[model samples]
Target chain A: MDDMTTKDVQEPYTKHLLHYFDGTSRYVLIKDEEVPFPEGKLIVSRTDLQGIITHCNQAFIEMSGYTEEELIGQPHYILRHPDMPKVAFKDAWDTVGSGVKWHGYVKNLRKDGRYYWVYATIILNIRDGKPVSCTSVRRKPSRTQVDACTALYAKLRQAEEE
Target chain B: MRYVMTVSPDFPPGQIAGWYIFNTWLQRQLGEHIHVELYSDFEAQRKAIREGQIDLIYANPFDAAMLVREEGFTAIAAPLSKPDEAVIAVAVDSPIQQVADLKPGTRIAATDDPDVNLISMIMLEPADLSAQNTQTQTVGTYILVAKQVLQGKADVGFFLKDAFAGLSGMIQRQLRVLVRSEIHVIRHVLLVGPRLRERHGDLWNLLSEMGENDKGRDALKNLGLQGWEMQTQEDTEFMIDLMDTLVN
Candidate 1:
């Protein structure tokens, strides 16, 4: 049994270092724990078109398990969970690239190898009819919606791998 | 104060000339006491919203959702449209039958409207046609996309189902549906600003009930839409979920 604990991960801020193990190497971190979302709070971040973080709020920094300095220049996908299907991101890019707002449930991996679910609202900042950047506002997702998305994402992943 | 209303330029500048005529009739029905003016520029509409100068607006589902969520506006009603109502079309004689048949060099045409462009991109996903792979021509309107495909200027076109359904017989005969997207999105929507809803709920109710009433039905017919129906919680939620999945 892998008994990696938070204390064991002395260098928790390192990008590729891990403190949790899910028994499978497919994911960078283990989903051994779930993070609790704060009530009536929002996790907010802004990214360039390539998804390099430009700015993020304190709540986003706290929930993401990354310090503000570590997150600012990093790609937003650093927190992506392996369980997510590529199709969802494809649809999101297609929608937002065309200058429309997109909403979806996302499961994000934490720096400590835990995970949390959020209902994310992403809007592209349009300048001269083209997207210059994107802003995302995230709130805690309902259990029902999370369960529904998990099943749907599993199906999508199966179809994708085939 | 006169209420400000804006329309999306989903249709080309002069093609749907009836829109100007229809909004004029709608303003009269809303009563001269509630003066309404119509404009179609999206940038101008965004400006008005940013400045809190607009009162009511008729917009695509994406804009309507954003306005309601971020701009102190509320969705009151949406036009009657099927959830998954966008269709990709090709010339009837073309060999392209399914999404996989689309090649790297194939010419794609779509309206400049954001909804149409996004739906077309989503529809093309199955073919793995990314920005690096395929090219797109932004035609002025849905009708022009159909015309472009039919005239062999483009290999495939994207348009709303209603636009294709209302095309001229000859043009309709020349095009065939390549695929219909499975993603459901709301069509046009009606939204009222916060002040309008707070201080003039009765007036707002009167406008909202127009679709179910007699005079409102006439205006709807002229506008080429069913009467406005109240936006349900389920509908708003669906759009919100769809918005995240469909972003570029």
Candidate 2:
């Protein structure tokens, strides 16, 4: 467990340093350890149209449990758990693609199959003639909101799978 | 006061220059017995209608639905042009050539007004299109979405056909239509608040009949070529269906 935790910590920084030289990093720091894991802090990489995982910070790797090498070329959905609904992601994508911010609750899966809930905000970065990348930040969500969302998402997921 | 009926945001308020022209003409017809107040935003106009701020509203199908559902406003007439058809487009160079080409991880751009644009997009869903793994961005306007797609910022965009009329040449040369909706009668509907329904039945009848003469034709021309038509529960039902699809 200790080895795994240590690997998680070093992997993200190494990945960030290797892929992104601009000194910008994606970091997710949990402000309260006592809070539920799903309610903790989360930071995601900013990527361009090619979907490269250019940068990640320590907290992202620690929580996701992937080595730096495993995360870099993978699409963001690699972290997507099976429990999430396709429509929620569809809605989120549609919202951000239009150059508007999307605020919603999400349930993401960890590498270990544990699920977490987050209050997520995503924004698009347009530079020059194209969209450079999108950045997202997530924080521990209210239990009330999560509980309601989980039930709704479960129904939506079931419908999609059917 | 003269009553001004304005189409909600679903229609091109800016393009519908006829509404103002008609309002001025209608004022002449009414001889100052009533005044017109035109509005483009549905939510704002809905609030005004609910609070008894306006005597009449020229609303879209969706707005008319909300009025019937929540506030008991009566639909008086629908516009001549069908408002339900939404055109989905992508840059010519984009990999998305058809709705089926939209795969997981595809980045799609849409307008911020989900109730209007998003609902229209949903109505245009292809039989085999699955929205899995799609990432979407919601800009506030159709033009912004077009600019984004033109600049290669987004892979797809959805907007009304009329909204893109000015850019048709550029779009035809640079972009491809992924899908086009069947002709649904999109209308700018006339609605009366519950309080004014009985009191103003004659006004409604007169307005509907006004298009039979030169003065009426001029007034109709001013109101975006929308002449007076009868209101029906069916018109209200169409709007309700749109609203239901939006929420679901």
Candidate 3:
């Protein structure tokens, strides 16, 4: 261990971090509350290349139950509800990472531990012909949509864990 | 990686050879494999851009606005002191001498060059003319617009100032300028995508001072440029804001 080489030091730590963060949340809590997403209002948030939140609109703050100051510098995955299949976010990253738009039903955890559902569309904000950031616009999802995604995500999460 | 460079089709046909020579200069200056690809019209060029096929471009003001905002293009430089302006004209033999004489049904010829059209429409406001009151016939090029006015198919024609200048002297003699826009801030710009960003600083240095050298001056002459001037993000953002205001 004392004779660890430069190549060994760089390779292991890099691969280790990638595995730890991939589709993983930093924290989670559960509470018996469900917040209703107001109709006709869009919830928008912008994140940097690494998925750190940069900007958020008023609807995002209200839906997430977080203040603007608290939300700006956090990882967007802070809202990763336990019910959401990690593969859903992985798919979102894969699509937007390749400079394509991603559309999906997302269940998000609020600051107080309640959950809300949204129909989300994600796109990259480009500069110098490279994607530098991402913007996600969310709208209210129908009850039918939420129920379908809920059932589908449960099956996916079970398959992933097994 | 191989890179593609393109220009707005609005450039005069006389400058086609000039651009090939300039492309050669760019390759030598950057020491990279850059290929030239030109489109016949704005629609085709925009299609290529959206598909992410272009690595660098010398774009018109209107398309430049879209590139900066919608696409991930960075503006590097623009032609020094060469702001784009619009010109409105009538045939030398036309009975209408001024805009004031223009009637509600006056026939107008125009191209879809957005910036020029915006300014041209504003100039027509003095005559109580508008999209509803005036008759507009969209043509393929400034040349066709000029031809329509000369043949009396249209009583008036709209052209970008440089495109009008590119017309032959005989065409110039046959037309009378009703007015020309003096908005001195809008111009064509050179931009690069992320692929060529590594050369951004060096490209700017070479371009901003190219007018001082002998070979560069020859290339500039072919493109009708005096020199390249530095364009920052703020400069481009300001112009985009102005265009949005005009559009709204």
Which should have the higher TM-score, number 1 or number 3?
Answer: 3
Q: Per-residue CA lDDT of candidate 1, range B1-248, in tens?
A: 46666676564344354555555665665553343445455666677778887777777766765786778676667666644367788999999987768877778888756776666665665455655677788776677888888889998988877777778888889898887654434466677777666644554576567677665676666677665566864456446544554564
lDDT of 2 at B150: 90
What's the best-to-worst order under lDDT?
3, 1, 2
Candidate 1 residue A76 Cα shift, in angstroms, is: 26
Q: Give the TM-score of candidate 2.
A: 0.53
Best-to-worst TM-score order: 3, 1, 2
Residue lDDT tens for model 2, B59-156: 66656566766777777676666455567788988876656455556566776443446434453332222254466787767778788889888777
Candidate 1: DockQ?
0.03
Relative to the unseen true structure, what is the C-alpha lDDT of residue B208 in candidate 1, on a scale of 0 to 100? Answer: 68
Model 1, residue B181: distance off in Å is 2.9
Give the lDDT of residue B232 in candidate 1. 61
lDDT (Cα, tens digit) per residue for candidate 2, span A6-123: 3233322211111112333332221111224421123445545444566555556766667777777766665665556767877887887887777788776455434566666666
Model 3: per-residue Cα lDDT over B21-102, one tens digit each = 9998888878999999999888999999999899899998888777977787888998888988989999998888866678
* Top lDDT model: 3
lDDT of 3 by residue, A1-162 (tens): 011133222322111111125444243445556787663355767799998999887888988988999888888876777777778988999998997778888998776666798878787766556776777877556566788888999999899779
Per-residue alpha-carbon lDDT of model 1 for A1-162, expressed as tens digits?
Answer: 132354523443223332222222222635546797654345777799888899887778888887898888877777777678877877887888887778888888777777888878787765435667787877656666788999999899799779
- Which residue pairs collide, candidate 3? A128-B194
Question: Over 4 Å off in model 3, which ranges?
Answer: A1-162
As a TM-score, model 3 comes out at 0.59
